[model samples]
Target chain A: MRNRTLTTITVVLAAGALALSACSSSKKNTNGGGLGGGSSANNGGTNQTYKIGFVGALSGPNAQLGINERNGATLAIDQANASGKYKFKIALNAQDSEGDPAKAPAAATALISDPTVVAVIGPAFSGESKAVNPSFCQASPPMPTVTASASNAELQNQGNKCWHRIIPNDNVEGSQGADWLARTGAKKVYVLSDLSAYGAGVAGTMAKELKAKGVSVVSSGVDGTTTKNYNPIAGTIAASGTDALFYGGYDAQSALLAKALVAAGYKGRTVTGNGGKSSVFTTGAGKAGNGWYFTCGCQDATIAPTAKEFTAAYTAKFNTPPSTYSPEAFDAANLLMDAISKASASGTATRTSVLDALNKEDFTGITTQIKFQANGEVQSSSLIVNLFQEKSGAIKGLGNIKELN
Target chain B: MSQSENWVQQLPQNIIIGLEQGSVYSLIALGYTLVYGVLQLINFAHSEVFMAGGFGSYLVVNGIVGHRHMTGVMVPLTVLCGVLSGALTGAAIAWLLEKVAYKTLRRSGAPKLAFLISAIGASLFLSNLAGKLFNRLPNNAFPTYFDINHQLFKIGNAKVTLIEVIIVGSAVVMMIFLDRLVNRTKLGRGIRAVAEDAPTAALMGIDIDKTISRTFVIGGALAGAAGFMFGTAFGVSNLMGFTPGVKAFAAAVLGGIGNIRGAMIGGLILGQAEVLIAALPFVGAQWNDVISFVVLVLILLVRPTGILGERLGRAA
Candidate 1:
């Protein structure tokens, strides 16, 4: 009787274990299939929901920036969905890229594989976007992508019509940055790059332009991605005795450099490319970031009348003011939706049709007029340069938004 | 003005800079070796300890010091607080790990694979935890406490900053102190004994648990110091430790796991190799990671036990 009872207990325990294993395997499959299904199926009916994929650095060091961009895209989608303009609802499939170039390809591949995905919104950092661009271009029927944050010139060099950016490339932004330094009558400028492709590329271009304009480019240095202490480099800037300091990098290192420069008693003007124009920079560097300037492709919140509505809606929904890239994201989503509408009207909204629609797209966005050049460069005005104020610890619009002729 | 002459003149300066940078790596590598020596385990979370230490220093400098700019008292205080916090955190984690993961397994005589899997899970958990806690924004700067721009010395054409001198000098001093503690102390002996043969050491009256806990504290303290220095020197973020932790682990392995002096030598060599690789033309800067990993793989292939063999014990 005791032996019989033991055998029954053993059978029940084994059955439970098998059930748990089966459940775990199913969960993994669901996660993988969900991403695939979410992107592939457009709800396939008259009342179908159209999906747009967004890939960005949502969970790493740049999570805040990524979330802000995602928020802007969400706002646009929500508004469109609520407007009842189409036969389908808009759904977003957001994935985190972690701001790494290596991770961007995987994220891009995941988004591109989804057949129902009409367009991709972003992979914020220029380096990541550039890395993923080729993979996107090679996709069957070629995915039409609109980056909210990427501003590198090289991205447009692909010569593919599938890519349309809402943000202006760094060429305009870099030229604007150079012009700002030159307009201030700064004779000598010290330049430092983060040593990444994006940073080195922008800093090199800025330096070249500055040098061509007869401005003395003194003391160029390269910093590693892991660089935290900017004192040694900051001291070089201080000692170089340049009128202004220009850094081409993201906010983390840029903020530290700003603080280090101030600590080293550097009283000169400071400037950075779009990558440095994050709220984290202001928060991290605090008073040190004050009076520092950054040039970005997007207009400041104050400059965009439409942004006031965006700000109100964003703040009400997310409980925070949108970051610098928020407007660009809004523009990208709206621009894509415009393309989608055009494509659907023409015929079945296939990838090739969407790509054609994107190329021919010309709509006035919240930030600026969204139109793509033959090279996939956004035909738009130059970026606005904002100055970070020490007292407010916030970036203030500096009345320097330049239009590219 | 000749190319060869310029190259000759630059060599000594480059070496000095390389050595100074290598010293920082060595300090972090020591933590990796200490943990591996006693437990026969790699604490992937060590880098997070380094990151946490940096954040700890940032908090101390920003909150307590109340200075946005570097001041004289800020550096030492930050480092002190950083090390304490790191050691405390490490000790707590080591204890918890033993209680929750390793202890039951040790009793059951579980396989080594289980421990490794558990360590990886713990690492991912801690890293994600930090990401959630820190608002996931890359922190650009911690408050500077001192002017790092002052030149301490010049080697021919190369100029060395005061910060470099401090970093190298402090790292060496700490290493020497650690060497003495591990070689000449009773706790050190027990740690060495356990690494040699855990069951035998247990039979010989060594308290394996206590030794392991102490080993973790020591490693954590070293990592903490590295974190403080790294944050003050470079910057800190949620994912800051991932790459460096991998590199330091590589350094530990290259120096021969469970070997102290090997770790020191391996770290300095790796740091210099990375710097030199970055300087090579055509290779460009982006190839630094590629070069480091290739070198690591090659080194492991040639010398499976690393350059120093595991029998060197805990003496550096």
Candidate 2:
């Protein structure tokens, strides 16, 4: 009788363990293999709840960008829901990617598994966008990912039918940045990247442009995300006697690099791409951050005439001023909503219908007029990248990138 | 200039930077060595202890120098306050760790493997707790009261900043103080005795538990102080300790895991190797970690035990 009871307990425990392992294995597979059996059959009707998913860095070095984007999207969603123009209610499924490519797949998988999610706002940085775009494109109905800030030029050529970018890619920003640098009379430039898809792509383009412009350029790579010490790299740059240092990475690492360069007595023109345009860089670099230059496709919403009302609303809602790409995110969210609205006009909005509508969208936004080319690139005539400088510890806009040349 | 000339020009500054980086590693490594000396266990949670010190000091420093332009004597005083607070916080956490993770497990007669598991569990809990409470940003700078990067001197075209001076100077002083504490005092003797043979030491009227606890406190104080210097130089964050912590652990092993002096030497060597090798014109800075570990492996292969192989019982 005792042996029988023990055998029964063993069988029960084994079964429980097996169930636990099975559950965990499924989660692991979803994370690794991307979303499978992908999109759910969701019919967007009156009073139906649809989730607009956002995947980006909610908490990390690049969190300000994601948070800014999230806030803008949130405002757009709130405005849409309150307007009562749409028959369906929109809810945001904001997922944190932590600005890491390795962590982005899981966040993307989470959104794809949900049947109600028709559109995604961002995968934020270019590396994450690259990592998750295939999965998004491979989803059953192809979940549409409308990115606000990912600017890698090669992203549009990935053959992902559902991927759309509202910003001008690195091909424009990088060449424009090189032209500006050359106009600055910098004979030699040291180009550095964080080795991310975005950083490398932008830096690569900049190097090619600089070489074409007859400027000597030296290129190197570093893992900006985990590296805390930039002193050695600073020493390398200082010793090279480069007239300018072009860093293509996020704000936090750039700030550290700026500080290290100062300590190493490097008196060169320091410039970075849009990724380093945050107050995090300016503040973290302290006095060293002064005189650093930045190139960005984002507009200064606080000063822009068209963005006055959006800025007021954003500040009132989020308590902080709208940061880089906030206006763009607002536009992207509105564009998505317009697509969703169009999709639902005839019948119910599905992932495929919303994507089709997105491909055909041509709306005027605060930043620029948005329109996508056949390859998911923004083809706006008014698309502009601006040059910004940190003077006396505050970032000041220095007009347009094209005009600088 | 030639390629080698460039490296030669940059050598002095790189050495100064490496020294600053190495000193912090030494201070943290001392804690790991101290714990291992008595318990014969690697406390994986020591990294979190270092991180906690940064946050603790950040709160104190931020409270004292909030938006105020500190001048004159107030600058050094504020720094001193930060270091003291960090040390105290680290010591308190280490004590709690010993009681909860080590003592309880030992009292229950748990296997040695359980201790390692518990230490890791404690590390995860503390780091996540820190993230939840403090800023989760990876580079949360401490409130800047003084210019941390003000150039104090130049040697061979290499400038040395005030923060570097403070880091190396304080690390040397603390290591000396720790050396005396482990070799001179009655507590030191007790700790050495316990580390040598806990059962026999108990037989000789030495309180094994108390000595072990004090060892942890001493190590914790040093690490906490290092955390302050590190945070001041880089920035404070819940996750700041991982890299330095890993480097310090390797340093401890490189110098001889249970030897106090060995840990110090190991850390300094590791730091310099990382800087000099990575600063090579052809190699680049991305190879910093790989080069340092390669040096460590080479050294270990040559001297299997470490650079200084004597255990804490004899070396301390």
lDDT per residue (tens digit) for residues B1-316 in model 2: 8768888877888899889888988999999989988988898989989988888898899999999999999999999999899999899999988987778667666667777867776776677667666656767878779988898988878888899999999899999998898899989889888888889999999988888888888888888888888899888877788888999999998999999999999999999988888878788776766776788899999998789885874334
Instruction: For candidate 2, state the interface root-mean-square deviation in angstroms to 1 decimal.
Output: 8.1
In angstroms, the error of model 1 at B271 is 7.8
CA error at residue A151 for candidate 1, angstroms: 0.9
Tens-place lDDT per residue, model 1, A131-163, is: 887777778878888888877778778665577
Candidate with the greatest lDDT versus the true structure: 2
Report, to 2 decimal places, the DockQ of model 2: 0.28
lDDT of 2 by residue, A174-272 (tens): 999999999989999999998888888999999999999999988888887668878778888988989999999989889889988887778889999
Chain B TM-score, all predictions listed: 0.87, 0.97
lDDT of 1 by residue, B179-268 (tens): 888889998788888887788999999988778777876776677667766766666676677777877888888888878888888888
